[model samples]
Target chain A: MKLSNLLSEKRPAILERWFDVVLETYPADTKNFLQKQNNQFANPVGHTIHQGMESILNGLLSGSDLQEFSTPLDNIIRIRAVQDIAASQAVAFILSLKKLIREELEKSQRMDSFIKELSLLEDKIDTLVLMSFDIYMQCREKIYDLKANETKRLTYRLLQRANLVCEVEEPGPQQND
Target chain B: MAKFSAKPKDLAKIRYTPPKTEWTETPVEFREHMFCHSAKPKDLETVGFPYGRAWSAKDDDWKLPDNWEQIILQGMKDLLGKYRSFQLFMDICVRCGACADKCHFFIGSGDPKNMPVLRAELLRSVYRGNFTLAGKILRKLAGARDLTVGVLKEWWYYFYQCTECRRCSVFCPYGIDTAEITMMGRELMNMIGLQLGWIGGPVAACYMKGNHLGLEPHTIKSSIEFFLDDIETLTGIKIEPSFNRKGAEILFVTPSGDLFANPGTYTAMGYLMLFHELGLDYTWSTYASEGGNFGFFTSNEMAKRLNSKIYAEAKRLGVKWILGGECGHMWRVLSQYMDTWNGPADFMEVPKSPITGTVFDNAKSMKMVHIAEFTADLIKHNKLKLDKSRNDHLNVTFHDSCNTSRGMGLLEEPRYIINNVCNHFHEMPENTIREKTFCCGSGTGLNASENMELRMRGGFPRANAVKYVHERYGVNLLANVCAIDRATLSASMDYWVPGVGVAGVHELVGNALIMKGEKERTQDMRLEPLPEKEGSENV
Candidate 1:
């Protein structure tokens, strides 16, 4: 099936804006990291994050049949596992995806924009999968309601420091070794 | 699928009945009392921009009811009527049940009502019947019931039942956080004066005085002095974290709680030691020394007022650079709001550690440093002395906090510190750890004994993973850089995962160090050949 109708035709601008937010929020250390390693988005962490997203997005794009980065849904829920590196919150991260959807749909035509929008929105929702798993590991601790100022600063600092993380989820379960 | 169940004889263990008695009742109505309402609509136009003036507890005396029962009922109503986001989110849920299986607590406790979406319905249903157009028009025809007094009391009960972990948002198609529900719940409960004294007392203290611990100036400086001596004793270093030193190169600020507490204090020591090693010109601000940002748990004013102290103090000191401590929410406040409070601190200088000349341009003035980022840069540049052999037995694994790890995406720097220092660093199960990791069961100050069951259940998933690694890999040590995770997880690890120990990321690094006075402590690479490790177990 076509991807445009899924997103209902607002995917291109969403994609650019989304990438812009994610890229801008990329942590200071990340650019530093790229320079130091002399590899752009090709580090160990980068590969894992890209692979995780590739599986989730590609799966939805191909009508849930994409098996390239396949891992059963229960074992390793598809999401941005490496994003936990730089501190983030519910707003900015989700916003990044929303931005991505708008960008993708904006660039599409009437014939396929709808499906593309839906597909991208589906890909964007992958953040929830990432978040649920993220909160699951941390559920070991007490989670508090973030005070308002905290909500703001934490999001900003996280945005500033976004580039530092290796957003790659290497497509293997925790090795039994 | 495993039947999710938790009869947590949590800290102040409550007597448990059989499954029939506990699980039979549908206690969904209790969702209302724990949440508050908005005075305005969400700013969907500019999604990130807050829609209305922020909610403040300072002015919470807004016409509460008389006669205690009616007062609570009235307060609960006012709460639902208060925040626009709470109201908007409640009105908007499509009940897709997308978040049904995402709750770790619901899974751990085996409570069906614990499902995040259903748990939300406990409050949302009331809002619908009372305020929403559809519910009011067809209350009798649909499942939408009126907000009765009974519902108000129930709202108080179950809303407090949630730990505000935000797990459900991950599955939410619209990305709604159930933690927001919990926060609204808490805000409403406070309005009615039905409070968990533990968090309430600290909130009041922090708003009035700056930190949760409400540490006084002399005591704070003295505490830093004491940690300095402790470092001197353990690592044979006599470096003092200079306080109020005029015109220092960098201003060091941390949650004063760390200055007094164990693992936090140790983390503070790690920062100071690294500064000393680098011979950096950093001074501690007695005023802005509080990096905790208690304002985070309450209203924007409290958060802003608390955060403003740091910038003002920075201005007072005339320092060109500022650094934050290893606290989770503290980093959140520092990273986002500082620029808003005093835009573009023109006097502020980009941090330059003379010890490690790794230039951080983005981190110049408008940036804050996660201690691990700073330390990772040091290690990456080979500035600090090395000893990989001493950390062999550590078998360290990282406990990534939701705030620092996921909120900020600071995964690599901490791991860089851990992998560089510890020999056998193991990763926990993929989805159950990292940016999407679980909370330490007490991150938002849900550490009261009354919340013990929540802590135990919330913390069970993490304990299970630690148990997995410890039993499987002989990984006796859990090394995390976040102070709260170390403190809370250490408590849980000792209680649940016996024979396993937890340490700060720096403690491990410090242990494996070629200290300035290594001969005095212990010459060998072992973490501590001396008896120093015996009692130095705070962080």
Candidate 2:
């Protein structure tokens, strides 16, 4: 049987394990709350991770040609970026997928024909890990960009008051179009 | 932590480590995205703010005028002479550390800078260095330090971290308010063009467009029309709310967050539904649309300028009194600052709730009544019919917004309204509620998405208390009156206490309100599936 078919067959168990592993990174105090929360709106971080991981897993296993794989990757990493964890720890969850898949493949007892296919899958996991890194760094950079933008805004008036800069005119307010 | 003989003997029993930093030489790091965005050259220019220019916070050079220090020192001298609070607060702090552990930021992050006493000391140190004899003579010995570019950066970093929640004031032996000190720091920062975007953008928007989010006249009408459509769908009642209609009995004002953001918009819907049911005479002005003043976060003069529109619109529309919607800092400004800045408002009469006929004597001075006070009175008079079982699905917890709890002492009215509307209501830990309430963490214009880490830290204690109730009693809905709370608590709850959603107090009121000629309700304000709609759902 193909590795894709095997992955499809064990999708729920694989996804559940991945979810548990990702959730384990949070502090013990908040980990239990995230685990027990079932409401989608109320626990959006968990829901996003749950939904995002499912999409990512389906996409990865189906071997469908897809653009914007990092979109779902973003959902998982953005929350982690703002979390207290370091950058490496934030992206470590992506690598866990590889371990889970390897375990599942070993349990199926098909080590010969699928060997090359398994290597190909492992390479894809490496690429995903790279993409996760880029996304995490971008999230961090975006945070700094916001801070810079806010500081500039906070002091704009002061600059004008001191005659240090020139004023630019704003477009007039529009009534209902 | 600084071990000092000056530390109060009674306050020494506290467990938290005092934040010890080298006041003279500590250089602030901007790596953390906790600061607000810089004001755009155009937004600042449009509002006639001084020094409107393109400057980068990331750049090493801030492009200050040659005499920036003199400018700041002059501003300080001017403020000290004008406001007695500024002068007294600057002079009186003994570093008792009473206000240290009380701050949510300190409690969550353990950053000594977040400690209320230390947060104030950021500016107080500067005051001592520049103005006091002890600071000039003793220098570091007096805890005073020269104001350098690095010290200016430190001021910008630490002041913005404070939500100006005033929780520390409740514990201070000297009655020192950190919020006042923070305001002074931010005001001084503004003179040097170090404003944060979360704050300055709204101030600019509110100044020019007459509302934050820069909603033009047409967008305001369209947004209300959308809510009207939702009101008709939910209650089978069409609400034709007047926009800027003259001679209305009262002019309705709320934060523009309610007009634009989720959860807050739901509360706006509740107001429309209740007003429609009672046939109350009121009109919403596109001009005075904003109730929450971002200027209050920046400085006193700008806050006063933003607040002027409220009474101006009231007088122009010939309304008798103003009915304010569910907002936290809006109440703080209205209750404490608005009258002093813009009053006697003798043009307006004391607000009498049209539905309940209960005169709001507490608000007689300002002629503005809080929506909770008005709604609680309606419930007391038994004016509107309610179905508490409609909200049976949500186990609710009340988050007292910092401004309302501490600024105005509006402790019971919201709870009174919530208890009447929802059967399951839980108070957070006693220490974290009422006047001792933790801020939503992102208040005072710190609710930007980029600062989620800072907000989560600030919001942690509030969320921790929420987690306690959530685990113990299964509370799923967190309700508060402030628009900033509605906007921010969503993120905090998602992080610390996931599965506990934030809502405006009125959203729940709308859920339980049974209209006189309504269809059988099947959804809450957000149009989610109502409990009875779930065929096999448990009660």
Candidate 3:
């Protein structure tokens, strides 16, 4: 059987393991709360991680295009980007999935073909990590943008009040003299 | 095992679980983005706060006065005696954990200390250790700890984390207002000159200049004049709003945020349009320009001092009653604390609507009416012609600003106003609205740029609810009745759920209000084109 088919069969277990790996990055109290809370609105960070991980697992197992993983990666990374974590740790969850998949697959019958397919799957995980990095940067950039925009928004009318900002006139049709 | 390796097993060994020490024993590591900068000495001096010195949260030494611990303990002792609620809150918490999960900060960041119960325990433990005999005899066993610099740092870190939105107090069976505890906590900290710059700066500004932004009298006029320009462009009716004019029937006071900020400025325009349409006799006061009191975040006396401006301005202007604009904590202070602090507003009448003759008997003591209550009364009386379809572009969801909802019991007025103004309005999830509403998470001077990460975490639950409505109902706009909500929720929306904009409740009213003999408006107050006019030549 192909590694993808094997991954598809073990999707639920792999997703859970991946989520556990991600949750481990948080403090002990946070991990406990994230694991215990089931309400999505009440535990949004946990919900976002769970939902994002599920979508990411599906995208990986289905051999979807790497670009298709943007939304799921964004769902998770957007949170981590603003969380009190290092940038490396923010995207480290993507790499942890490679180990999680490997550990999950090790329980199955390991044929010669599995090794070759495993390397290819690992390569895709690597690419996903790269994509997660881009998503992380985008989320960070968006935060900075929001910060700058807040100041601008706060001072916008004040600037106009100060005669510092003015509306430019729209270009009128040239008169044929 | 090697920390970094090409092999997956070796790499996966780098787990990031926290240390296994108990919470009280664990020292706080003041990381960047987790805390705000300390208050500058100048701001402290401006308010005559004692022990004012240059300090940073990142520093090893906070440069405290030698008797800082004594000051805190004495301050706590005075507060315990002065405020019965403070002492009761200190003693009466059963730790039922009803409030543990209610904090938006806890739900978002998963910090155990962010839990309202635990956050309060940080102070209660000290009270136990120092104030009670049981705490002195059996310290650790009684859950009491000595007031070390470490504990003080912990207090500063956790207290500021609280927005004082009081979602926790709602769930507490004993009705322990943790917000007051936080206020007490902040008040004690201010005794040591440990106020946050965001809170202190604004408190000082509001103290000196009558507004948080410190816009001078002429600047306030010009700022409103800028809004007048937009209102004229939109409705083609030039609104000449009075400033500091005596003998006006209503003295209008709003958060200076409305006069300075984006969506808030739009809301300011709404108030102008609404007042102009009704031809109400209202005057904006430069002296009482700020409705939202940052002084409330500092100390009770400071809050009282700042709040005195409104009644003073109203008296000076000789207004019949005060009509407050759409703001969150301002209404909380107005409805809850204003009369107690600066009351017997006997000079002003019982806020009877000049247009509809509807008496707001609820505000008879305070003699101030919320714009929502005023607008709801207007709509109920059918006093104003509203073209609700004008707001068709916005699939609106009302975010009950924490202060307005939980603090002031102003649950219905904003909703009534929204239903009357907009074509499409959807309520967020039941738990996330009304009395149980989550904060914008940037309240009580926590809305600083340095603490964006903290704000984002604190805002996650609110934004999560907004995301639900945004995805399900295609809700594009978050309508709130708070200026802070208008400012902070915009950042939260942009971060968590992009494409959904935040607006003041009055901004929607400005959009839907049809003025007499006004030219056809192609745009809303934000100068964005109206729904029907979108992509049309009229835009």
- Highest DockQ: which candidate? 3
Reported per model, the fraction of native interface contacts reproduced equals: 0.00, 0.03, 0.62
lDDT measured at residue B463 in model 1 versus the true structure, 0 to 100: 70
Of the two candidates 1 and 2, the one with more favorable TM-score, higher being better, is 2
lDDT by residue (tens digit), candidate 3, B301-354: 999999998999899889999998988899888898999899889988888998
Please state the Cα-based DockQ of model 1 relative to the true two-chain complex: 0.01
Instruction: Rank by TM-score, highest first.
Output: 3, 2, 1
User: DockQ of candidate 3?
Assistant: 0.49
**Interface RMSD (Å) of candidate 1:** 18.9
Cα error, candidate 2, residue B515 (Å): 0.7
Model 1 lDDT tens row, B33-131: 123232221221111212223332223332334454454446556665776677678777887866764565554443456668767877777666666
What is every candidate's C-alpha DockQ against the true complex, given to 2 decimals? 0.01, 0.03, 0.49
lDDT of 3: 0.87
* Distance from true location, Cα of A140 in model 2, Å: 8.8
Better of 1 and 3 by lDDT: 3
| Model 2, span B101-165: residue lDDT tens | 67777655545567787778878888999899999999889988877887787888888889889
How do all models score by TM-score?
0.63, 0.75, 0.95
Badly placed stretches (over 4 Å) of model 1 are: A1-177, B1-64, B67-88, B140-143, B341-347, B350-366, B517-520, B523-539
Q: Lowest-lDDT window of 10 residues in candidate 3 chain A?
A: A104-113
